[model samples]
Target: MSAVGPAEALILLVIWVVPAVVLFFLIYWAVRLAIRHEGRRVPSLHERVTAEREAQRREWAEREARRNTEAPDEL
Candidate 1:
Protein backbone atom coordinates (compact mmCIF):
# COMPACT_ATOMS: atom_id res chain seq x y z
CA MET A 1 0.00 0.00 0.00
CA SER A 2 1.10 3.64 -0.60
CA ALA A 3 2.14 5.80 2.34
CA VAL A 4 -0.54 8.08 3.87
CA GLY A 5 -0.32 11.79 2.85
CA PRO A 6 -0.02 14.74 5.27
CA ALA A 7 -3.63 15.95 4.77
CA GLU A 8 -5.01 12.48 5.44
CA ALA A 9 -2.87 12.18 8.59
CA LEU A 10 -4.07 15.55 9.88
CA ILE A 11 -7.71 14.62 9.27
CA LEU A 12 -7.31 11.37 11.14
CA LEU A 13 -5.68 13.18 14.07
CA VAL A 14 -8.53 15.69 14.27
CA ILE A 15 -11.17 12.99 14.23
CA TRP A 16 -9.54 11.11 17.11
CA VAL A 17 -8.40 14.05 19.26
CA VAL A 18 -11.60 16.14 19.15
CA PRO A 19 -13.87 13.47 20.57
CA ALA A 20 -11.33 12.47 23.23
CA VAL A 21 -10.96 16.06 24.42
CA VAL A 22 -14.73 16.54 24.49
CA LEU A 23 -15.24 13.36 26.49
CA PHE A 24 -12.59 14.36 29.01
CA PHE A 25 -14.23 17.75 29.63
CA LEU A 26 -17.70 16.18 29.89
CA ILE A 27 -16.59 13.75 32.61
CA TYR A 28 -14.67 16.44 34.49
CA TRP A 29 -17.65 18.79 34.59
CA ALA A 30 -20.01 15.98 35.63
CA VAL A 31 -17.88 15.10 38.64
CA ARG A 32 -17.54 18.74 39.68
CA LEU A 33 -21.29 19.23 39.48
CA ALA A 34 -21.94 16.16 41.62
CA ILE A 35 -19.58 17.35 44.34
CA ARG A 36 -21.07 20.85 44.41
CA HIS A 37 -24.62 19.47 44.62
CA GLU A 38 -23.75 17.12 47.43
CA GLY A 39 -22.10 19.94 49.39
CA ARG A 40 -25.33 21.90 49.30
CA ARG A 41 -27.38 18.86 50.36
CA VAL A 42 -25.51 18.01 53.55
CA PRO A 43 -24.50 20.09 56.55
CA SER A 44 -20.77 20.32 57.23
CA LEU A 45 -19.35 18.37 60.17
CA HIS A 46 -18.12 21.54 61.89
CA GLU A 47 -21.55 23.14 61.80
CA ARG A 48 -23.22 20.00 63.16
CA VAL A 49 -20.71 19.76 65.98
CA THR A 50 -21.11 23.43 66.92
CA ALA A 51 -24.89 23.12 66.97
CA GLU A 52 -24.69 20.06 69.23
CA ARG A 53 -22.38 21.87 71.65
CA GLU A 54 -24.72 24.83 71.87
CA ALA A 55 -27.65 22.55 72.62
CA GLN A 56 -25.71 20.83 75.36
CA ARG A 57 -24.75 24.17 76.93
CA ARG A 58 -28.38 25.29 76.96
CA GLU A 59 -29.43 22.05 78.65
CA TRP A 60 -26.74 22.42 81.30
CA ALA A 61 -27.75 26.02 82.02
CA GLU A 62 -31.39 24.99 82.50
CA ARG A 63 -30.42 22.21 84.89
CA GLU A 64 -28.23 24.59 86.96
CA ALA A 65 -31.04 27.11 87.22
CA ARG A 66 -33.50 24.46 88.35
CA ARG A 67 -31.08 23.19 91.01
CA ASN A 68 -30.40 26.71 92.33
CA THR A 69 -34.08 27.47 92.71
CA GLU A 70 -34.73 24.20 94.56
CA ALA A 71 -31.86 24.76 97.03
CA PRO A 72 -31.69 28.50 97.63
CA ASP A 73 -30.31 28.17 101.19
CA GLU A 74 -27.11 26.31 100.22
CA LEU A 75 -23.89 28.33 99.54
Candidate 2:
Protein backbone atom coordinates (compact mmCIF):
# COMPACT_ATOMS: atom_id res chain seq x y z
CA MET A 1 0.00 0.00 0.00
CA SER A 2 1.18 3.56 -0.64
CA ALA A 3 1.80 6.00 2.27
CA VAL A 4 -0.79 8.69 2.99
CA GLY A 5 -0.14 12.24 1.64
CA PRO A 6 -0.61 15.49 3.68
CA ALA A 7 -4.17 16.09 2.44
CA GLU A 8 -5.26 12.51 3.18
CA ALA A 9 -3.61 12.67 6.63
CA LEU A 10 -5.45 15.91 7.50
CA ILE A 11 -8.76 14.33 6.48
CA LEU A 12 -8.13 11.27 8.64
CA LEU A 13 -7.16 13.41 11.64
CA VAL A 14 -10.33 15.49 11.32
CA ILE A 15 -12.59 12.43 11.01
CA TRP A 16 -11.27 10.96 14.28
CA VAL A 17 -10.71 14.20 16.21
CA VAL A 18 -14.12 15.72 15.59
CA PRO A 19 -16.08 12.77 17.02
CA ALA A 20 -13.67 12.50 19.97
CA VAL A 21 -14.18 16.21 20.78
CA VAL A 22 -17.97 15.90 20.49
CA LEU A 23 -18.07 12.77 22.67
CA PHE A 24 -15.94 14.48 25.31
CA PHE A 25 -18.35 17.39 25.50
CA LEU A 26 -21.35 15.05 25.67
CA ILE A 27 -19.82 13.22 28.63
CA TYR A 28 -18.95 16.50 30.31
CA TRP A 29 -22.51 17.77 30.03
CA ALA A 30 -23.97 14.51 31.38
CA VAL A 31 -21.72 14.66 34.41
CA ARG A 32 -22.65 18.30 35.02
CA LEU A 33 -26.37 17.55 34.77
CA ALA A 34 -26.07 14.65 37.19
CA ILE A 35 -24.29 16.76 39.78
CA ARG A 36 -26.81 19.58 39.51
CA HIS A 37 -29.63 17.38 40.88
CA GLU A 38 -27.43 15.24 43.15
CA GLY A 39 -28.22 14.75 46.86
CA ARG A 40 -31.55 16.53 46.41
CA ARG A 41 -35.07 15.40 47.26
CA VAL A 42 -38.09 15.97 45.05
CA PRO A 43 -40.74 18.56 46.10
CA SER A 44 -38.02 20.48 47.91
CA LEU A 45 -38.92 22.66 50.94
CA HIS A 46 -40.09 25.66 48.96
CA GLU A 47 -42.06 23.61 46.45
CA ARG A 48 -43.82 21.72 49.21
CA VAL A 49 -44.82 24.99 50.85
CA THR A 50 -46.13 26.48 47.63
CA ALA A 51 -48.13 23.35 46.89
CA GLU A 52 -49.67 23.42 50.34
CA ARG A 53 -50.65 27.04 49.97
CA GLU A 54 -52.25 26.38 46.59
CA ALA A 55 -54.29 23.51 48.03
CA GLN A 56 -55.49 25.66 50.90
CA ARG A 57 -56.56 28.41 48.49
CA ARG A 58 -58.53 25.92 46.40
CA GLU A 59 -60.26 24.58 49.51
CA TRP A 60 -61.22 28.11 50.59
CA ALA A 61 -62.69 28.88 47.18
CA GLU A 62 -64.82 25.69 47.27
CA ARG A 63 -66.15 26.57 50.75
CA GLU A 64 -67.05 30.10 49.63
CA ALA A 65 -68.92 28.76 46.58
CA ARG A 66 -70.93 26.35 48.77
CA ARG A 67 -71.86 29.15 51.17
CA ASN A 68 -73.07 31.36 48.29
CA THR A 69 -75.23 28.57 46.81
CA GLU A 70 -76.95 27.74 50.14
CA ALA A 71 -80.25 29.49 50.78
CA PRO A 72 -80.42 31.82 53.80
CA ASP A 73 -82.86 30.82 56.58
CA GLU A 74 -84.79 33.95 57.70
CA LEU A 75 -86.85 34.28 60.95
Candidate 3:
Protein backbone atom coordinates (compact mmCIF):
# COMPACT_ATOMS: atom_id res chain seq x y z
CA MET A 1 0.00 0.00 0.00
CA SER A 2 1.17 3.53 -0.76
CA ALA A 3 1.94 6.04 1.97
CA VAL A 4 -1.18 7.93 3.17
CA GLY A 5 -1.39 11.42 1.64
CA PRO A 6 -2.13 14.61 3.61
CA ALA A 7 -5.62 14.80 2.08
CA GLU A 8 -6.46 11.27 3.20
CA ALA A 9 -5.19 11.95 6.74
CA LEU A 10 -7.25 15.09 6.99
CA ILE A 11 -10.37 13.26 5.85
CA LEU A 12 -9.80 10.42 8.36
CA LEU A 13 -9.14 12.85 11.20
CA VAL A 14 -12.39 14.71 10.52
CA ILE A 15 -14.38 11.45 10.29
CA TRP A 16 -13.28 10.15 13.70
CA VAL A 17 -12.53 13.24 15.80
CA VAL A 18 -15.90 14.97 15.25
CA PRO A 19 -18.05 12.04 16.34
CA ALA A 20 -15.78 11.26 19.31
CA VAL A 21 -16.14 14.82 20.63
CA VAL A 22 -19.92 14.75 20.16
CA LEU A 23 -20.28 11.46 22.06
CA PHE A 24 -17.96 12.69 24.82
CA PHE A 25 -20.14 15.74 25.47
CA LEU A 26 -23.37 13.71 25.39
CA ILE A 27 -22.09 11.29 28.05
CA TYR A 28 -20.58 14.11 30.05
CA TRP A 29 -23.86 16.01 30.23
CA ALA A 30 -25.83 12.83 31.03
CA VAL A 31 -23.53 12.01 33.93
CA ARG A 32 -23.74 15.56 35.21
CA LEU A 33 -27.54 15.44 35.12
CA ALA A 34 -27.57 12.14 36.99
CA ILE A 35 -25.17 13.40 39.61
CA ARG A 36 -27.22 16.57 40.14
CA HIS A 37 -30.33 14.49 40.73
CA GLU A 38 -28.65 12.17 43.25
CA GLY A 39 -28.01 14.96 45.78
CA ARG A 40 -31.62 16.12 46.17
CA ARG A 41 -33.91 15.54 49.16
CA VAL A 42 -37.62 16.22 49.27
CA PRO A 43 -38.33 19.92 49.70
CA SER A 44 -34.90 21.43 49.17
CA LEU A 45 -34.05 24.48 51.31
CA HIS A 46 -35.16 26.96 48.69
CA GLU A 47 -38.40 25.12 48.08
CA ARG A 48 -39.11 24.86 51.79
CA VAL A 49 -38.48 28.56 52.31
CA THR A 50 -40.68 29.49 49.37
CA ALA A 51 -43.48 27.27 50.59
CA GLU A 52 -43.25 28.73 54.07
CA ARG A 53 -43.36 32.26 52.77
CA GLU A 54 -46.35 31.44 50.60
CA ALA A 55 -48.16 29.88 53.55
CA GLN A 56 -47.51 32.94 55.69
CA ARG A 57 -48.86 35.22 52.98
CA ARG A 58 -51.96 33.05 52.66
CA GLU A 59 -52.54 33.03 56.42
CA TRP A 60 -52.14 36.80 56.64
CA ALA A 61 -54.61 37.32 53.82
CA GLU A 62 -57.11 34.95 55.49
CA ARG A 63 -56.74 36.75 58.82
CA GLU A 64 -57.27 40.16 57.19
CA ALA A 65 -60.37 38.90 55.39
CA ARG A 66 -61.85 37.54 58.65
CA ARG A 67 -61.00 40.73 60.56
CA ASN A 68 -62.55 42.94 57.89
CA THR A 69 -65.73 40.89 57.87
CA GLU A 70 -66.04 40.83 61.68
CA ALA A 71 -65.25 44.51 62.40
CA PRO A 72 -67.99 46.99 61.53
CA ASP A 73 -67.06 49.86 59.18
CA GLU A 74 -66.69 53.27 60.87
CA LEU A 75 -67.20 56.32 58.64
Candidate 4:
Protein backbone atom coordinates (compact mmCIF):
# COMPACT_ATOMS: atom_id res chain seq x y z
CA MET A 1 0.00 0.00 0.00
CA SER A 2 1.38 3.44 -0.87
CA ALA A 3 1.50 5.95 1.98
CA VAL A 4 -0.56 9.15 1.31
CA GLY A 5 1.60 12.28 1.58
CA PRO A 6 0.21 15.50 3.10
CA ALA A 7 -0.45 17.14 -0.29
CA GLU A 8 -2.25 14.10 -1.73
CA ALA A 9 -4.37 13.70 1.41
CA LEU A 10 -5.27 17.37 1.40
CA ILE A 11 -6.27 17.22 -2.28
CA LEU A 12 -8.54 14.25 -1.67
CA LEU A 13 -10.19 15.94 1.32
CA VAL A 14 -10.84 19.10 -0.71
CA ILE A 15 -12.37 17.10 -3.58
CA TRP A 16 -14.81 15.38 -1.21
CA VAL A 17 -15.57 18.43 0.92
CA VAL A 18 -16.15 20.93 -1.91
CA PRO A 19 -18.76 18.82 -3.66
CA ALA A 20 -20.57 18.07 -0.36
CA VAL A 21 -20.58 21.76 0.60
CA VAL A 22 -21.90 22.79 -2.82
CA LEU A 23 -24.65 20.16 -2.76
CA PHE A 24 -25.70 21.24 0.77
CA PHE A 25 -26.03 24.88 -0.25
CA LEU A 26 -27.98 23.96 -3.39
CA ILE A 27 -30.45 21.89 -1.39
CA TYR A 28 -30.81 24.67 1.19
CA TRP A 29 -31.54 27.30 -1.46
CA ALA A 30 -34.07 25.10 -3.26
CA VAL A 31 -35.99 24.37 -0.06
CA ARG A 32 -35.95 28.06 0.96
CA LEU A 33 -37.29 29.15 -2.44
CA ALA A 34 -40.02 26.53 -2.36
CA ILE A 35 -41.20 27.61 1.08
CA ARG A 36 -41.24 31.27 0.07
CA HIS A 37 -43.30 30.55 -3.04
CA GLU A 38 -45.76 28.41 -1.10
CA GLY A 39 -47.33 31.51 0.44
CA ARG A 40 -47.48 33.58 -2.74
CA ARG A 41 -51.28 33.73 -2.84
CA VAL A 42 -52.99 35.75 -0.12
CA PRO A 43 -56.11 37.88 0.53
CA SER A 44 -58.12 38.14 -2.70
CA LEU A 45 -58.93 41.59 -4.05
CA HIS A 46 -62.42 41.55 -2.58
CA GLU A 47 -61.07 40.77 0.85
CA ARG A 48 -58.47 43.53 0.57
CA VAL A 49 -61.07 46.07 -0.55
CA THR A 50 -63.38 45.18 2.32
CA ALA A 51 -60.57 45.52 4.83
CA GLU A 52 -59.59 48.91 3.47
CA ARG A 53 -63.18 50.18 3.55
CA GLU A 54 -63.61 49.05 7.11
CA ALA A 55 -60.44 50.87 8.13
CA GLN A 56 -61.55 54.08 6.38
CA ARG A 57 -64.99 53.97 8.03
CA ARG A 58 -63.36 53.58 11.45
CA GLU A 59 -61.09 56.57 10.83
CA TRP A 60 -64.02 58.70 9.62
CA ALA A 61 -66.07 57.88 12.69
CA GLU A 62 -63.21 58.88 15.00
CA ARG A 63 -62.72 62.15 13.14
CA GLU A 64 -66.42 62.97 13.33
CA ALA A 65 -66.47 62.38 17.08
CA ARG A 66 -63.46 64.66 17.62
CA ARG A 67 -65.02 67.45 15.49
CA ASN A 68 -68.32 67.29 17.37
CA THR A 69 -66.53 67.54 20.73
CA GLU A 70 -64.58 70.63 19.64
CA ALA A 71 -67.57 72.42 18.02
CA PRO A 72 -70.02 72.49 20.93
CA ASP A 73 -71.08 75.92 19.62
CA GLU A 74 -72.73 74.23 16.62
CA LEU A 75 -74.99 72.21 18.90
| Tens digit of per-residue lDDT, candidate 1, span 1-75 | 999999999998899988899999999999999999987887789989999999999999999999989988756
Each model's lDDT: 0.93, 0.89, 0.92, 0.93
Distance from true location, Cα of 32 in model 2, Å: 11
Worst 10 residues of 4 by lDDT: 66-75
Per TM-score, the best of the predicted structures is 2
Of the pair 2 and 3, which is ahead by TM-score?
2
| C-alpha lDDT of residue 39 in model 1 | 78
Q: Per-residue lDDT for 60 in model 4?
A: 100
> What TM-score number comes out for model 3?
0.47
Ranking by lDDT: 1, 4, 3, 2
Q: How much is 20 displaced in model 2, in angstroms?
A: 8.1
| 28 Cα displacement, candidate 1 (Å) | 0.5
- Write the residue-wise lDDT of candidate 3 on 1-75 in tens digits: 899999999998889988899999999999999888887747779989999999999999999999989996899
TM-score against truth, every candidate: 0.48, 0.50, 0.47, 0.46
Model 2: what TM-score? 0.50
Model 4 TM-score relative to the real fold: 0.46
lDDT tens per residue, model 4, 37-66 = 877968789989999999999999999999
Candidate 4: Cα lDDT at 33: 94
- The predicted structure with the larger lDDT, 1 or 4, is 1
| Superior candidate under lDDT, 1 versus 2 | 1
What is every candidate's alpha-carbon RMSD to the true fold? 7.9, 5.9, 5.9, 5.7
